[model samples]
Target chain A: MPNPRLFSLKSDSIPRATIQRLALYVQVLEDLQREGADVISSESLAKACDVNPSQIRKDLAYFGKFGVRGVGYYIQDLIASLKRCLGIDHTWKTVLVGVGNLGRALLNHKEFKLRGFEVIGAFDCDPFKIGEEVSGLEVMCTKRLMEKSHELGVEIGIITTPPERAQRAANHLVEAGIKGILNFAPARITVPEHVVLEYVDFFHHLYSVAFNITLSQQK
Target chain B: MPNPRLFSLKSDSIPRATIQRLALYVQVLEDLQREGADVISSESLAKACDVNPSQIRKDLAYFGKFGVRGVGYYIQDLIASLKRCLGIDHTWKTVLVGVGNLGRALLNHKEFKLRGFEVIGAFDCDPFKIGEEVSGLEVMCTKRLMEKSHELGVEIGIITTPPERAQRAANHLVEAGIKGILNFAPARITVPEHVVLEYVDFFHHLYSVAFNITLSQQK
Candidate 1:
């Protein structure tokens, strides 16, 4: 289920960059927590995340104060707050479409469960992959997506189909009432303005790093 | 070989955010190029990229002007400039570590080669996968990473290993003289100050979309 108060706050006030940074903070915080770090100073957090300490302080300030004056922020408390703020404190029922290599990797990825995005259904158009078990879920044909999504209350739709079929997968998800889509397909698929969509383009990261390395070498 | 002229022009003047947006612009431009569009206005590009039109103009301004007063940007001109600016015009010889699902998916991904990133070598610790061929490259044992990387002149190292082995892969790549790294492993591995590192955490995108969908629902 969607968080009731997720948008109750003024989105206009919170910059998109802040939201992105908040996600980064949560990742770094999660790593720290895994390393048995009980408390972390903003300086160390910033360093780990490769951002300025002041930026961390400012981002957290938007959500209210959580850091103690001298001891830094409690790891568990900060994680909890960030999770709640990012709307990941509760489990989100998700479905995965396209069970190709990338799709299977995502299905087998353990990190999603740790963050509460549980893939309850898997679908693909390939007849050979249909009925195959991947990471505990039996793969279903794409035709059943609309029917099964409604039955399972799938809230998040992940499209890992090839570019040719990505739009079809997206339409199926939208017709089934998925609230969010994380598209891994290279094709850009249109979604309703109300439905949240994020593209995980590996090339984007590749180009960014390529450009940064080029710039750094110039120095 | 690294682009020499990449930094002869000012580097400090450009914001990293602009570098990122440049990547986005390139992606959109490439798509348009495939569709056979020769020229595109900033407004249309912004709509496709989901960024403000003004933001697009500001980003392009960093790398010198390419837009005509009334005709918008020449698609071929923008693509060529972006490739040069992002250092993707020349092929980057890259090596991949790990032959797992994600590794396999990345190996099979054609977009990288299209963008001038060629996976010249593949490495994994698993004995069974070491001799296998994936996407025309032989998967070598991790022990051979240093030798193979040097032999192939690998400049970009892609670590798709599990979290536990990610750091080792990074070290191996660094020791082998890789200048940049694209890490798909969940673990955050550190490199020397000079080495460029970019983490492609799928969970980050998952969480971002989840939060966004929650916020959209609340509205």
Candidate 2:
């Protein structure tokens, strides 16, 4: 139940924690819908998502009212509103840089399409990769990244290049006017203030879990 | 500065967010040390890590005093303490399942070694991939996962299989006595409550940035 007032709130006013929680909610609601659950209470949804029930209510309140006091939330309606709120309702055209192993996995990853992200183009510096078709899209040379990205109206850039080349690839993507970037290169890359950059460091995730386990064993 | 009291605190008493921040601090401190910096203030560290200065001080206080009020924190001391706190001071033997493109990327990812994680073994069901040498280790059949993991004293299990096989791979890993798992299959797989599972979904990161950018544009 996203209300009009929630929709009108200033974007900057919303806490980043709330936005992150919304992402979790989107996944949880989608799963609930698939399971044929038409109505879900905040407590049930929180348990399914491994979050606190009160946290769910607080986050949803920021987005607008979505629950009827006693009956809980309508799963389908919540899914649609969360999608609209997260902007996944519209397909985002994304370009992948680097056709290396990680890049190939990304191209073959079907979940992206299911979540409204379409990898429309790919770029690489290797001559062997250029002109090769992967996931039905022909790989282009990095030289054409800026030009091709603009031509295809790509809004998001995914850099799977090596650490040494990540910064250059980021610069090219920024020049191409990408509004957001998901950089898989372990190296950090700088982007303009207007563009959002999120690094996907699989090692970070591994390290987090490993650290916890190590600490527990020490006890 | 990390205090002795912080070191004495039980793992459960420390917040997960604090641990995550410690990981980020490890990276930042390592980078600063390499650049030959001797001392860093909370304010400077916050700017570098994109975190609040007060938050940095609060997190560090949990571990113990490492910084001098006037001169800031000693760079080398901070690095060692963070690494010790994160359990990265000791290497963790890790085994990877699914030697596909993503798995290959993980094996070749040098950051793993730098961060104190050693991928001692790799597993895959594909006959073509099994026995192939990658990043100095030969790929083994998935059937050998449990036996080899036990023999090698592997502490972590990394799953990079397709969504359909992710759960089975996880079960195999759990059976092998892995204390932690980092799954890259883009599918949710359950593990025993004792085991920690972290999912690496590139779409989730992309969605996070996309949502923020969309919200900004709406304003």
Candidate 3:
């Protein structure tokens, strides 16, 4: 059982790992829902997520009391609760900077739209790329980012620029009043305390695989 | 100082969090080396990595002793050691399935090649996609996966197929003698005990951003 008052507290009070797990739970729950599952026991859910059953119970407990004795959690209700906790119940307007191959793939990525992130604009500095239509949006000049971001009330900025240009692109997005940034460039960029930033490191998993394979071979 | 004997132990004895931090340290150290820095104190490295100085020291200590008392660590030597620890000092052959937009972007991504992963083959089931050239590799029928994988000595498989096809792709890769899999589709997959699997969840970061943005707004 969890203290109901914990839900009213600021989000920082909750561990980020817990929040990330909650996001993952939402993903798993949605899958179950698609499979026509009406309910799922904590043990079953934890198995699906590759986590301990008690860990699942503890994470959900941080938000509020969930599930019923012996019966487990109702799939639809649990999904709604987790989504609300993750702030994905409503659509988030986003602007993408850079129109390179990775950028174009992101624009065409249906998962973003399905998950409530709407890429309202795409911007690039290349004159050759400007005015080009990609995934339905006309590629706009990077100079117009601020104006369009404001006009669209964009909340998040996605950076897929080259490493050399990443910092400049982040600067433009912050200047455009974006609240969050997801950087795909293999470069580190600084942002203000108010703005949140996450990196899409493409090599981390590969390194893990390499390390494990090496270890297995050694044994 | 770390016990030198720990370095000879199997990698599982090491915490995954430590391995992940080591991976991050490698990234930060590489950046520093590129910037012409020859030595860096743990404090500086920690600051750049957004981790505590003591945490950096603790994570590095698991492998072996690092850094000098005052002059800190030698950047070039440290990178070489960390890369060797990560098993990325040598090249790992890989193959990519589902030559979609995301797949095409990955083929053009220079980071994989730079980080020692050679994408030796591109594969798809579509007749129109088969025989098409992408990033210097001809798209082959998925049916030939095992033959080509054996010929190329591929160790890793990259899955960028749609959610519905992801499991089948994993099955194909496993049968093709892949030692590890990196799945990009938004689906849960199962692989053999000897084979490792990782997911590129594009939605996790977006969910984090949404949660944080919502929290910030409430504040």
Candidate 4:
């Protein structure tokens, strides 16, 4: 069982960087578990994650200590603890707005289901796509977003619309009472202070790569 | 014109956080320019980007000083300088290795071309997909990756293959003499020291959102 203190720790007390690292550690640990590794030393985990062992120790310590001295952490225990810490231990009711090529790809993405995000609804504004079947979910008109979201109790909304429509999609999601949004569009959209918004910007990553490649050449 | 000193500086001297901020600033500036804004006060830019004005000034200062006394920055000049600083001033010849749904969406992503990343080739191992048209480019067999990449001078490789196939796709990309890779597959793959690898993990963002929502509920 996860330490009760883990859930009791105020989220504001945790650094955003630590949460990011913890999320990454969960990914690395899942891979390790799938590979049939029962236990992993901090050193090995650090190497796999490309981070210092001490940093890993610090990140995990923010919640509670788990690794035994000299023996390392049990893969199964850490995975469960990290999942709970990340609030992904239970399913999150999710809705995806926009059924474009990108939106279709996201609907078919297996990882979201595997990671506890259940996309219960798919909505679009295109009349042509309104009745289309995509990844087992029938595309519904954007008008149904609020009613369906309320009826289904959607907790997260994903926007994969074009740049021009991103903000509008975000507005609809907010009106639908979504608590969180993950936007994959190139444009930036605003949400209420109470709602959490995150961007999946491919260009940001590409720009970083371009900079690093240029830097490597300079060396 | 950007200062030659910007390119000459050692990449190691600039922190990774600053590079990320610089990329974000470019995006914000581009939006401002699109809206016909020629000049913007640092306060407004900071508010738009949700960062402190001092932080923006500090990030821009890492490359070279630009903002004038009290007048703030000229949007066009800042965008050009930041783009050059981030090594995206010129087109980067790129290739995609997975012709799956995500790969197809990426090929159709207009922002890539608009932001100076030109996809020169799209390769996949699926026999059925080979020779199919995707966003104007024909999908070729993965076997042709090396030859086509070398012949076309490809610099960046995008992997949208399934997790089980991600490593193989990465190996093919590395063998194709690619300098950087933007992997959208939900798996981690290693690259040589000279190559830059970045992951577009939607799960990471979703997990953060989940955590935040859970925290907000507690409040």
Of the two candidates 3 and 4, the one with more favorable lDDT, higher being better, is 4
**Fnat for each model:** 0.76, 0.61, 0.57, 0.72
- lDDT (Cα, tens digit) per residue for candidate 4, span B131-156: 99999999999999999988998999
DockQ of each: 0.75, 0.51, 0.49, 0.61
Tell me the deviation in Å of residue B77 in model 1.
1.1
Q: Which lDDT tens digits does candidate 1 get at residues B1-219?
A: 875776244336677667777887888888898899998888999998889999988777667766898889899988898888888998989889998999999999878888889888899989999789999988888888788777888889899999999999899989998989999998879899888998887777788887777776665
TM-score of chain B of each: 0.94, 0.92, 0.92, 0.94
Supply the DockQ value of model 3.
Answer: 0.49
Measured on C-alpha atoms, candidate 4 has an lDDT of 0.87
Task: Specify the highest-lDDT model's number.
Answer: 4
Superposition error at A23 for model 1 (Å): 2.5
Taken in order, the candidates have interface RMSDs of 1.4, 4.2, 4.9, 2.9
Stretches off by above 4 angstroms in model 4 are A1-6, A10-13, B1-6, B10-13
Q: Residue pairs in steric clash, candidate 4?
A: none
User: Which stretches in model 1 have alpha-carbon errors above 4 Å?
Assistant: A6-13, B7-13
Each model's lDDT comes to 0.85, 0.82, 0.86, 0.87
Q: What is the C-alpha RMSD of each candidate to the true structure, in Å?
A: 1.7, 3.4, 3.8, 2.5
Compute the lDDT of residue A65 as modeled in candidate 1. 75
Task: Give me the displacement of residue B190 in model 3, in angstroms.
Answer: 0.9
Q: What is the lDDT, from 0 to 100, of the residue B14 in candidate 1? A: 72
Q: Write the per-residue lDDT of candidate 2 for residues B1-219, one digit (tens) a residue.
A: 112232444325776667777887888888888888999988899888888999998887776677888888898988888777767777889999998878888888778888988899999999999889999999999889889988999989999898889999999999999899999886678899889887776667787877777766765
